[model samples]
Target: MAEQIELHEQAPRLKSVSSPQDQDKGTSQQDDVDDTGITEASLTLEEQTDLDARRGQGFEAYPDGGVAAWLQVLYCFCIMFTTLGGVYSWGIFQDALHAEQLAPSSTLAFIGSTQATLEGLCAIPISALVARFGNKNVAVVGAILSGLGPILASWCTKSVAGLFVTEGFMFGAGQALCFFCAATLPSSYFSRRRNFATGLVYAGSGVGGAALSLAANGLIKSIGLPWTFRILGILFLAINLPCAYLLKPRPIISPIHHGAQGGLTWGPVVKISLLKDIRFVLVLIGSAVALFPLFVPPFFLPLFATSIGLSSGAASSLLAGFNLASATGRIGWGVMADRWFGSLNSLLLCLAANATSTLVIWPIAGRVGPLAVFAVINGFCAGGFFSLIPGVVSSLFSDDDLPVAFSMIVSLWAPGDFLGAPIAGYLLQAFGGPDSGYEAYRPAIFYAGGLGVFSALMVFGARVKEGGSWRRRL
Candidate 1:
């Protein structure tokens, strides 16, 4: 009987020891939950928490001063300068083309309008493609096309129609490539300092535009338009080479079995999310309306200068000043947005200042000094609009959704971009051209300023609805 009792007690002890092994096996099974891939659902609680923390930090993914990151930035700067510079220098080319080859102010305006429209419109498809194939590959293709377009244009028959095909269609296509590459790459690098990085990249556009305008204007005066275009094409090619080598996306491992197969698919998820987001919709509309007037001044500023008695070289220089000021403004405003204030708050302030500067300052800028000041102020204020937009959009959605959101906004803005410059041109002709003394452009400034004010009010309304004060946030 004692032997039987001892045996029973020993059995209980053995079972207790075996229980821990069973528990460990269960844990091992749980750990295998993500063996297939990395998906949102597969992430551990800790991983999700870490992701949220990173998101809150804003554009912090990029390694500060790392060779790869800085090289990407450098490439972005070149791309920005070439594409944006070309856009900013529209006035110089428009003035020259209108006078020499493509005569009639209204006709020449189509070139700028078409280029801007294409640049914006192309982003929709390009963004998706980049998401699928990766930015480095897409950017290289874009750079080649952009760099070669001008060279091809230089060989075209020099008539309005020919110029339209070469300069408008070809060159515009190139610009679109450069623009997409620059804007998209930075989105991949930094999450916390995104605005600051983006601002710096975009500032290169103004710098490129200013520097190129000065160079192009001087070259055009000395060697004429054909050789000038050829030289610009060479410069574009040189600047684009490094961008092709450097700009790349962050490595993201997918969890779904075929997730990497189709790249980023456009599905109900994208549609539903975008449609449900009222803030995004309003911001997109505001972006379109705001961008409309921004291009008008740069498009016609050189012509306006000539109309007011400045020489061709002097007029071109003013255009350069406008771009130079714009570059400075972008960097300065970006810093303020990233460091001092929230992106949304900075946007509102910029819109208000842009409106005030345009209406209050530009109307009286018939004289040289005042015009210069107005250009600088307008450029500076306008910088905030471009710099803060992506960050503000980012605040509304997660990283995975960013490419689609950005694409949608760009697609929506295409029509407005195409129409803006042409409308300005018609308005200019209606009021008067250089012969009529720029009276038409004066009214145009007021219209642009009014739009800026209206946009600010919309943003303010959104802020109020969100129960936040703009000043407090800033």
Candidate 2:
């Protein structure tokens, strides 16, 4: 009797709300409620409606393997090739600036050091800028700056100050932009294939470095530094043009009730991630420390070879081999990471290899064959470390937080880079010259290897705490 009375009373209320438009809306609401179960504690109808509005702002679907995404990847390859090629080509430039230009070795070293420092240090501000203005704008500006730096450098005289401005500051700025933009783009386009995408993008650096090595070597012999640098700059601009067009941000849907202008703040996001997440901190620290020694070999390998009685051509060849090995390593490790091991495990394996190769192989590389083998091995291991870091970082943080996370990691890396080369130089000085019959590079290698080991242990501890091997899924 009570149920019948209630139904009788509710029929008039239902009838009153049952116009054609109201009926359609009511049906949709019920469907939505069924799709995501409604509880008494759930948001009010207005709140739910607002969320639906916001969800509509997101992209309908990502073009995972679309032409645009591939083009973006290609553009990234070119950008990396130009920027990292320049970084890897530092040996040739240093020699030219010292021998042909009659600049002091220490002064030229400072130029390279400054460029390296700024490249790492600028990541924070540039990443923030990318977050605000989007990657295309940041990349275009960075590309222009990078393209123009070498062109301007071609006109510089033999002054350290000139090199500092053109090579260190300007070129450094350009490289930072290129690196950040390339790294951030594919993350927005692919989820399942992110590791592969990143590997492909980073492989660009190795390819660029290797190709530029041969070209720069011949150009230095035939045309000279000025024309060589100018030509390289033009090539860089060409590569960056396509990337500038292809890189775009993923679209985000706004909740219905809130305007697009109003969004969540960074504070709550960070607090929530940090309060509950330990992986983020661990990955960040491990990556930063592991990265400390990565650049050291590339920066000093040619010098190390030359000091060991190798000719310039032979030393350059060793550098080329290292870079080529690195290219192979990136692809191999990336594929393996995506298939067998997760990103964290891949990082651990790479770091262990780096530590082992440096500690065991490099210290004993006295003979030419041994040295060449060691160079290739070291390059491969270090390349794996580099290629795996971004994937590992992504595994720890959400997409919205990735820029800030990467920025922070890059910023922390500045000190590591600033110290790595100078410390290597100091180690060389402490050992007297290569003529002292004592290997200076041995101590430096051990130090770097030790840091790698330490980083690996940190990852291990974190993995243990998380109740899984590093190879396990996050």
Where is the poorest 10-residue window by lDDT in model 1?
Answer: 1-10
Q: What is candidate 1's lDDT per residue for 1-474, written digit by digit as tens?
A: 000011111111111112233456874322222223445445558755764443333323345446776677777888888877776676667667767755776777787677778867787677756655666777777777667766776766357777677678777877776676677456556655667787888888889888887787788789887787788888888878677667775533111122223233343213456767677667777777887777777777777787778887777677777778888877787788767776777887888888898889888778888888887888787766776777776655655556667767777778768776666666777777547886768767777788778878777665565455555543
Q: In lDDT terms, which candidate is top? A: 2
Query: At residue 287, what lDDT does model 2 achieve?
Result: 71
What TM-score fits each model? 0.82, 0.83
Candidate 2 has a TM-score of 0.83
Full-model lDDT for every candidate: 0.68, 0.70
Cα lDDT of model 2 by residue, 392-434, tens digit: 7677644545666666667767877678667766776787754
TM-score of 1: 0.82
Q: Which stretches of candidate 1 lie over 4 Å from their true place?
A: 1-65, 251-270, 469-474
What's the lDDT for residue 381 in model 2? 77
